[model samples]
Target: MLRDKIINAISEVGFDEYKEISSADIIFADAVFASCKANTCGNYGQNHSCPPLSGDMDTNKQRFLNYDHAIILNKIMFLGEYYEKMESSMTEVFELLDRLRDQLDDEPVMIAGPGGCNLCDECSAKTSEVCRFPDQKRYSMEGSGMDIVTMSRGLGMTYNAGDNKVGFFMMVLY
Candidate 1:
């Protein structure tokens, strides 16, 4: 019943593609963790849901593994010819992820999305303060060291949609 409920919620959120998998099947790699330290997205130590603040790789891995099942969801969006719509496209995906989060808010689930938590416009971590919403803090898939690209390929999900389109992924573990 819970799985059915989750599927319905995901459908309502209108993700482009989804796959159900055992939590154990989720992939984690040290290289992904290493990438976080590069701080290309600039959330490495700046967000509570991100690395250093979220915890070590081992901790993040164990957190996902503690769950029995996971649903990987993705939404594909088209960038402009020159990839100029990157920001807006990312915003749309985050909004979709937020809707999914709201739809399943009452359920016991852990959501890991494309980037750091955006619940607060400016994370309290930036001010060296405690997280304002610990319970609602969103985790990041790549930030947590999950090799999303590889996982997506293995699941036959779309990481690239061609024609200047790309997929943003998220996961709900329960």
Candidate 2:
């Protein structure tokens, strides 16, 4: 019943690709968190939800272990001519996570989305000392220190659906 509720939440939010898995099934590594700096997503020190600002890797790992279940949700999209539709794909995941969070409000829910928090057009980190929407800000799974590819593989899920089709994933940790 719980799984169905979660699936329904995903569907209600306009997402179709998702799988429920134990939180334990996910692989959390400090090395993955470290990659944020190397990858240089540009959100590094610009948002409170990203690396350096997201906090220490050890704290992130321990925080993840405090959860028991999560629904790994994804959105597959075909960008026109190029994979430039990433923002669209990421927004889809964000919406789905928002709906899922609303549906499961009875529980403590944490959503690790595709990229930096989109609650604001311009993050307050750029001009202010505090976040504008701290409560709504969702951190990326990668930013949260989880290697999605490895975690997906461990859970027997395919990261790449196909060429031209970019897949964006988010975790509804509860």
Q: Write the per-residue lDDT of candidate 2 for residues 103-128, one digit (tens) a residue.
A: 88775667778777777888888674
**Given candidate 1, what's the lDDT at residue 118?**
91
List candidate 1 segments past 4 Å from native.
Answer: none
lDDT of 1: 0.91
Each prediction's whole-model lDDT (CA): 0.91, 0.74
The top-ranked prediction according to TM-score is 1
Q: Which residue pairs in candidate 2 have backbone atoms (N, alpha carbon, C) closer than 3 angstroms, thus clashing?
A: none
Candidate with best lDDT: 1
Give, for candidate 2, the lowest lDDT window spanning 10 residues. 74-83
Look at candidate 1 and tell me the lDDT of residue 64: 96
Each prediction's Cα RMSD? 1.1, 2.3
Cα lDDT of model 1 by residue, 88-130, tens digit: 9889989888888888888889988988999999999898999
Give the C-alpha lDDT of model 2.
0.74
The C-alpha TM-scores of every prediction are 0.95, 0.84
Weakest 10 consecutive residues, lDDT, candidate 1? 97-106
